[model samples]
Target chain A: MNRSSQHPLRELAERTRHAGAVLRTRSLETRARVLYEALWALADKKAPSGRHAREALARTTGLSPEMIDWSLAALPIEQARLLMFAERAEDRVPVDLAGVVLAGNVFVAAIEPITAALLLGAPIVVKASSRDDAMPRLFRAAIREQDPELAEALAVVTFPGGDEDKERALFSRAESVVGYGSDHALSELATRLAPGARFFAHGHGVGVAFVVPPDHDADVTTITDALAIDVCAYDQRGCMSPHVVFVEPTEHVSARDFAIQLARAMDRLGQRVPRGPLPPKVASQQLQWRAIGEAQGGLFEGDGFAVALSSGFRLSPGYRNVVVVECTRDRFASAIDSVSRFVRVLAQNGQWVTAPADCRCCAMGEMQRPRFGETRDGIPLHVAFLKET
Target chain B: MSEEHKRRASALIARLAPPHAIPREDAWRARDAHLEALRAFQKAQIPVYGRLSERFGALPVDVLRHARATVHEASEDIRVFLTSGTTQGARGAHPFRDLSLYDQAAKAAAAYALFPDGSLDLCVLAPSEEERPESSLSYMLARFGEWFGERVTIAFREGKLDLAALSGALERAQATGRPLALLGTSFAFVHAEDAFAERGVTFALPDKSRVMQTGGFKGRSREFTPPEMRSLISSRYDVPASFVVSEYGMTELSSQMYELTLRHALNGDRAPIDATRRFFVPDWVRVTAVDPERLQPVAPGEVGILRIEDGANVDSVAALQTADFARVVDGELELLGRDPDAVPRGCSLAIDEVLSAGDGAT
Candidate 1:
């Protein structure tokens, strides 16, 4: 409720709006090139700016260096694929100015939205999360190297949320607003946006994995390995990170048995990749969740991960904690439906008889590395920033 | 009171009213015996505990896995008190079949840990039982007022602090030269302080004035660390820091613990009392800090999840575990904040409010 002086944000938004007009006249190819260059800049670790950006990201977001590097490596592929998909669409006109509210849960979350805005040729004004203010700055640095003109189109602002006046100034000037946060936060932000402004709300959502174990018993380990990677990605902080894995009962294996295997795989992956240090609060929640599951007689824990067989699905506090629930064909639909409101992506080993309509289904291990231009929460990110003309 | 309730209350009080000078080993043996008896009672009476005993071992932490379970039978005459659900929205219910026992435990604990000698004028910075019948804190304060045989001045009404009324009470107490006792959550004091400052009002109570600030800021407001709060209370009320006690309690338990500041002050220990250094647990309650993962007692001086073995919770399960982290020093608890990621629990419901206020994602 503490409002910072609104002059700075208002001034920045005005500048960004001016920049947006210049950006909208640019060709799609030029926008794509800018993204490609920024991606290359992010990977140029030898460069001082790149090194500084990486270090700042690591410190601010509490992500390990390896995880930051992995996220940076994936950015180029994701952006290129998005650009390719966007080119296929007709009747696409970039919004003059797009406002993006980025979440701080993952280190590289800003890159996707920023790149998507570029590909759409929309100058963007970003409100970076307090937890990771370095992300937008880093992206801006990368953009400057690619094209100083494109860099001028992006403005990153930082302030405590809930300053209605400052937020109103930003929303009123923008043609569209895209926000990523909890359902509550998205709704609250939506209420603040100006009438007639396009709003894209990516509310907090969870990912789950459905493993129909291979008909043969030998391939279980392979399935577990893929599932482990999905869980380890972003330390299960991203919405696409699996919190619960629904293992379908197979002739050779029970869901509990598969959970044990998955736990082992998680342990192996933890040793190889190693989780970043957990904030004390997160560590305590993880410990409490595991303890409660253990006391109930169904928890299997490894060094940096825990897999529990629970009757109901509960979202993990992240840090590689997962719940594995056994569901029969009859119960699978109802089980997934119960948590449908929060389900973003459902990664499965094979096909299911039926799946939720809204969630994007993918092959195991692909939750984190979705095929380029895949719809998130049923919305195509490729065209999200475009206004049909 | 029902005969059964009276019997249970007397038995619990007899076991928990011993002097603090009892040797550590002797105290432990007595506590273990009482805990064993309480566990047996819970297993026999509470079906959930019975199932937990069969499934997991009879450890208190294990039994508390079903903290949210409705364990009381339908036939029992019970008052169901719901937790504030500071962590998650699913509130834990603690049912009491015998109100008399709860009152007895509350009174005894307050006497030993807070008042000790005699009662003072009661001014509660919370709602009355009539306003919030389900609040254990309001109920406890009402009981305290009854014991003190004074008209309780409720400083908060309709979810707003009545600053004028609180200030008036302080003024009246000063005018009458009567010692006063202030009781409320930490946030209530902060709000009072802010209100007083805004109006340019300050008051120094009579010489024997004391305060019992319970409940931490559940992320609803800017958190005031214990020292900061002690300083604020001491400066505002003209009471020394040693006279400002912090009471540690929750809706789940019938008994409570108080920091020994008031006791030290009463004992004429002129040396500055670091209230944060130790808390006085009543004889009826045992506080243990256990490794969160293992649910086993952590080494003394190490921080861990706080587990309570409260003998006073006669109608419900006696042993409970909380998501709060604390350290045990010389058989006394050094209050630590709630586990950062631990689902918020308590009457504060601050987390739920903050989340609803837009801190949480879908």
Candidate 2:
């Protein structure tokens, strides 16, 4: 082929085309082995690249050391589950090429789609976010150590956003494009994809925790501790981080009282997983939100982390800024109705409650660490990204 | 506003606007008294504030936060001003039962900061009150127009800039040898400059010509540093950088801050306006930078959240806190940009490591 003046991305697409064909022919056993080995590589903390990945992710993302460790600890479990999920799946047909625009909110966030594409036998070309260019490389390194042939199918590239020519090159050739970012960014990227290209957009989302009154005497301290993790993990930057907790009133404690307990727990947790210095914008937003919450008759305590108790249904300005809105059973359901559109996960405590069909209801404190094969944003990852032949 | 409210506001204005510089202690005392009175008024009249005070310490910003969406008014003649809302679309609505207080504060602050030599030919680059009745900026410009009388010209209408009308007014002022004042948001000026550049138009106004721009880009447009904006204003209008003052105000507060540029320019001070340029508050307003988490005053020169005590805001809450990060320098407030909630921590280091790993070969 005469390739002078051809876009550089065309070569990248062409290189991945054969890998895509190879992926389709790969057995489920082969895929499971690759995934299991990759998981083992990630879990190997003694490995130099593994240690470097954790440190780099912690430093770049500004996630506390504990938060970084938590993410690293959770990844193996998630990947192992993905391994089992792939082993069970039979109708896996790989697309020619899949393009992924990963978000930098959390370092491990890049793994979700990358691993999903790998599991489904789709060759992926990832455009890593500038905020987190290290993560994709780390994943690629792990995969290469485990299965070199599988690693060839994945490509991670970094470029400044809004580069039209490069973006068109990627979109024109890719059978599917997955974008993770703010709603505006996702929409902007969606507009650039060629006709009939499969597009999956993950926009800004918030997670909320609903504390149902336990049948037994509630250990408020333990519950608060778990909720604190949900709030403090990734400094509440991830979409799965709990922004608000709606507590159902109990004989022992009122919803507002639970908020106060949650605040104390957050304060204690701050010492263990100290919140990193907030960026100027995040600090200002947290302050503004706190001020607004206070002015509106909400109680606010702005320590290293912030807690607000109000009747309002507004999402907390994430960065360990947690809002506790008091709600009865009826009001809790209604509040869910109002915020359901933006809620990605609803972490629940006490009794099992019916949430909006779209939101995933998990046990409290498990919001941030989603299990593999679980539907993210109510879309089953195993089947959602796969195309039927 | 009710006649009674107007009378109270007028009396407060008289106390605020002294012919000469009042003692700093006296100014602070008056401010504290006004704040206490306003707090008392809100607690009695606004149920939300009353509840919040009972729960949390009585901080005006705290009270304002609690009453963000609710209408908190002591009187029936209330006008609600809403914040532009965050990306999440949750706007904080502040109610003013007596806008006469707001009008008086705006007029007096403008007189001191913007037009110490008295109002000249005024050209506002924002929409009229009729066009955006809900906008506090539009309302303030309308008040300025009233203060400047018939010579006031508005160059923005129906959501568009009337560059022709602005150019005509500028030319008329130039021909008449009359000093002019151009007022608008920073983005509006950027738009005006771009428009003028497209047409190869520039102006050198009279010696005392001044420009007052407020409301930083707020991420709506590309942001220009203060020095950058001053340079653009200076070059485009042939006005000295010292004469291009920035107004710092928000809808939540009746009072405003202005850069000392106008005063410096009128005095023929050739000092170049740099990033260190500080905004001066009127005698009636006390501006302090407080730690965001503790809400305690930070040491001078340290960046902190801004909290204001404006005596002019007699009808509404007098104490307010804003998201703008600022620091006190030599008794004046130097604004930094809004505090970013989170800074990407060590991306440069990661990038370096990645490059060294030869992963950047792609």
Candidate 3:
């Protein structure tokens, strides 16, 4: 019998599961402290590993170095927030082995669930996307450097997606799994999990912004600058990143004027944290999107970004390409009614139309920085980890 | 349309109404003259195009979504062709004051491409235009049956494929020993393939039998690449691989593009069958690869979004831009489909990706 060959995930899962038992014996304060220290090290710009993470992520993630730096600097790694979530994990029975399937789309997407798992003292086996494993690997390294004892509870492994045998090995042992990707992918992963194992899916959703007619006292520069930050964050890749900004024509500025101003703002921001290298296919798509925008209304383009003033609204395939639609409040609601289900975040400067039920509303610039307790895709972060009765 | 503009438009349509063996330069001359006339006619006759051209500098094909793009209002249209609203919830409609030009253009192109040898029995796996007025492909297939089909069998009714009826059509073609043309959307063909597999049935239709499939899977069935689809259709229908033709037409344009495999084979030019398939436009339609940013023609052999000028689109805008990415090689289009990386790398779902799922072209 060729017994020498074993799936790598099997042993890794077993090791983490065993470590989770010991990890659970520690007080919630210690586990939270260990997790916070590691995150803090990565978030610190002065730290070597922190700088290395930004550089490594720039290479691995198609984002530019400046954008990577901006993204890393924006990560919400506050220890107080970590402790707040940690207190919720107190007196709860930790999951035996928590399986995490990370996607390559947004590198920072791997953080929250992994934090929830560790904060609850659950040993985690992470199946890092082959396209991006730097964040998970670097995170594990940070944990190892901070506390080797807790490092035993973390394992980051990489294999091509749809490797069912390896996926089965991880799914069979874990009591819970959190998968991220398109909805189709998450569904397939759910089918392969162990019978009783619970599945938490962070599927793809869209983000939109609304700019109401500003008050007489409102500053246009402040609004456009903040909105530009929301658009440029993650190169407009995150679900929280706004794809379209619906601007109401005020006595002060028209929608076209707003689009032109936003174009300039994107240009100013691009100079600071330039848009990343776009794949050829994305570049082609961007062109088509711009042409469509031109046909629909007018287009204002700049270095690495474009602001399209469209008569109607559609989500732009984000790489800092944004659509600015002018409409009344009634028209705005009607336009978004059909796509309300996919709307993740509705960013606005002031009170506009009522948001959809599952959508999270935030100020224009703060779309990407959701507070710790807020629900993602309608699921609270605290509920992500296993909870004991 | 105004009487003067309609008269000029009709004259242009009449000049390029047939698919003939005209020289390349001569063909371009006639098409360009027609394109010029059609653009002027559209801007003059359609109020919407005038407004759009003034506002946007050029009328893009996407403006077809606006009701006023049509010469006549939707309510007064002699016929309106609706797009498959697969990409977005809103469907684009191309309204016409007259259907004669559209019919003539469709028949001429299909005859030159799919039915090079006059009319044959057509087993259409799609609803007739009378049944589904919104589907332009359905309208064109129904026209194919009326103009050329000696015997017609529509196996698709009310959005479902009648497998028994389709089997009967195949059996009839075998019994009569006459060539048959099978036409349907790609997803319908996939369903037929599945049905045949389940029934343990395959057909060896008469010689010269061919298949014409159009449209993408659009999440309707299991997706197969173009080569795989060609092989599946050829084997399932027991036809020569070259006889399996794919049609590329959209609701926005009156003209359609077709692969030249069947035509070349019919002309006794036997090219070795490979995965590569290039669609040839009719003499009346000229396609150019335009850089989306510059809105200008790209260098030869470079891939860009397709900008098609159809002389047959007499009532609407002559110049239209399609989202499809392609390369124009020696007047033939090598469709690379939509941008594969159009979906962002982040967790945010692009609505276009969600709406046009399984949009296989290449």
Candidate 4:
């Protein structure tokens, strides 16, 4: 096929695939160095690209400057971890060219998928969400700044969702497409793909926390303080953000009391790493959730935060809102059964009941900060882009 | 129901019905007093309302889902009006001991806003009361058909609109050369329109014909703006844009609000139908936009969640907080659809999504 006559998407895909073949010939250490350089460039607050990303993400994401900084803190994956992932990924065969459909929910969500595909030695053409194209674009720019050759292996594109021509163009060029979005969108994308095309759908999921009150200590301040961080992080936009926390109430700490304390902690966090401004729709949803909370049991709220002491587990609308329900150990399993399928991350203080098989269990404060090499939605990060063994 | 509560219910019902009887001047005062009395009665008669009121200082309309907010005993002869459980499995139920108040309020509002120009045949594309006993919308449509419609044809069956039957009814009405009143949920109308479009058919009904569209897409059909809906209905049904009226009612409340376009057009108002499309609350109900978190009334024009006080809700909790965002301009409610359920911009599942997933739609 004549290069000049090729569709733009096909030309882009061909160029990226040629670069991926070149990338495959390079040593793992060289590729790791390229990624490491790009990561640090963004991590360095004083760097021009880093500064630009923070400000641009703040403007595009509606997140506060402080919140954007907090999200950036999760980046710059350790050099050692990258090397380990690359080493383990040696046997895996990557698609010739991979198509990535990035979600706009959380800007940081773009990092893992993009990195995973690169680690698997696959060139990628990413269609960034219109609502949030800043991070992916900035990340691509960062990579180009570090290594122009490696940057050729990545191309960031943007088009409105539901544009069939653009989607068909992508399908024509890529053997595999990885999507991060709501289930409805994922299903639609799946239907658009050709027969036998590989698709990895990272659909939306919820995170929940389980609080086991200290056996003797009356002060649950430490627990609430940490939980508040999880709630405020990314404005609770990430799948790992806790929407509800089921507290096992003891004499020392009651669920209602914990809700009040959590609300206070959220207020304090709101002052430091304040929540981003809520769009009118989110604010309205928060109000409706608050009313439902008020109806269910008790509601304790402050500016930009609410802690509803719900009688049953109710998912918060995110944006630093949370529902705290009281449950004894006996009723724990049955209570969580309702939301088990949607639960992605289960942050807990003590082991009471085993989490759902597919759910990731973590400590109270580390809900949003899954460790390096952690499998996302039960798939090894890099393996998501590789051929199934 | 207790004697004291019954007495208060009767008083509120009598005052609210025949909506014209409420004095135009200081109508808010009467409505406020009635709401105040109604709240007091709810506090005394409804246990859930009393508990929620004591704890939270006010009862939200959502309480209707958790517990019945009615004065009548559970065993008593009561009719329960249910909300479509779209969000969660929680379907809100408003129990009524006397359908008489509902009947009177329904007829009075429809008479003034929907049928002010006189009766027309009703072509309803929704389930009847016998088919969907718990649906407030079905009950209201059924009542409207009986009270004002000279001929009624209900074409909804088994969760689907019988478009063929609806088309036949339209043809019959057109043949009669008598005016018609078509009533259906927005989704139902969209279904009919799509079905008609596929068959390359459209209706040119008789003069004075109108369409009453209520409810939202609920993810059932494609969504359209108010102007778009009016245009679609107008073009497809051969009615003027002003004849496309939108009704806004919820199961938790007794009173329904309607767009003033039809009533205004009948009254010789020359304004464009789009400009006059704001929903008008009856004199028997007070609609206030209140701060969602604080639950306090916001400034007149600022948007807030609507908190309605319906005197017609004499048997149930009267002060109902709806999850709809609206603003008041010139005493008319400019409804901005239901407060949208939180959509995860990120990859996190929203509450509504999770609930719907559990229902197997995922």
Candidate 3, which CAPRI tier? acceptable
Query: Tens-digit lDDT track for model 4 on B1-362?
Result: 34554454445445534444756546667667767777887788877778766534456665666666777787875788777877655777888777877777777778878998777788899988899999989999888877888888988988889877798789997898988899999888888888888999988998889999998875442778878888988999899988899999888877788987887888888877666368877766888887766667789988887878777777778777677888987677988877444444657777567665654211
* Candidate models: Cα lDDT each: 0.73, 0.71, 0.78, 0.79
For candidate 3, write residues A1-389 as lDDT tens digits: 22212656787788888998778777777777777777777887789879879878977888888877777776646677777876775567777888889888788877777777887788889999888889988888887887787888888888877877778887678888888877777877888888888888877777888887464534776788889999998788887778788998988888888888889888999999998877656665675566566655577888889898776667776889998988777787777765677788998887878888778999878888777666777777665566546
The superposed Cα distance between candidate 4 and the true structure at residue B2, in angstroms, equals 11
Write model 1 residue lDDT over B177-265, tens digit each, in one string.
98888999889999998888788777889987889999888747477878988988888889988888888888878888887767767
**Residue A363, model 3: Cα distance from true site in angstroms:** 2.6
Off by over 4 Å in 4: A1-7, A218-221, A249-254, A257-261, A328-333, A387-389, B1-59, B71-77, B163-165, B291-302, B339-344, B358-362
* Comparing 2 and 4 on DockQ, the stronger one: 4
Q: Write down the TM-score of every candidate.
A: 0.74, 0.80, 0.89, 0.90
Per-residue lDDT of A62-181 in model 4, one digit per residue for the tens?
A: 789988887786699877888888777678788778888988888887787777778668888898997879988888899889778888889888887777667766666677888988
Candidate 3 residues B1-362, lDDT tens each?
A: 45554454455445444454456677678667767766777787776567556533345555555344755556668777888766554577887878777887787777777888889999988887778988888888888888989999999888899888899999998998988999998888989999898888889989999999888875553778889888888888899999999999988888788998898899899787575789988777888887755667888889877888777777667677777788898888989887544343536776655665532110
lDDT of 3 at B125: 89
Worst 10 residues of 3 chain A by lDDT: A1-10
Tens-digit lDDT track for model 2 on A1-389?
A: 33322877767877876687776677756776676667656656777766877777766777777767666766764445666777544656667788888777777777777787887788888888876688888888888887777888888888866776777776567788877776656777888777788787776667888886554445777788889988888788776777778887878788767777888888888887787667666665666666556654455464678787767566655778887877776777667565466677888775545676667788878888787767777666655346655
Worst 10 residues of 2 chain A by lDDT: A1-10
**Residue A331 shift from truth in candidate 2, angstroms:** 4.3
Off by over 4 Å in 3: A1-6, A21-37, A44-47, A210-213, A244-264, A279-301, A306-313, A323-335, A349-355, B1-21, B33-59, B70-76, B352-362
RMSD of each: 6.6, 7.4, 4.1, 3.6
Best by TM-score: 4
Pairs of residues clashing in candidate 4:
A105-B345, A105-B346
Error of 2 at B278 (Å): 3.1
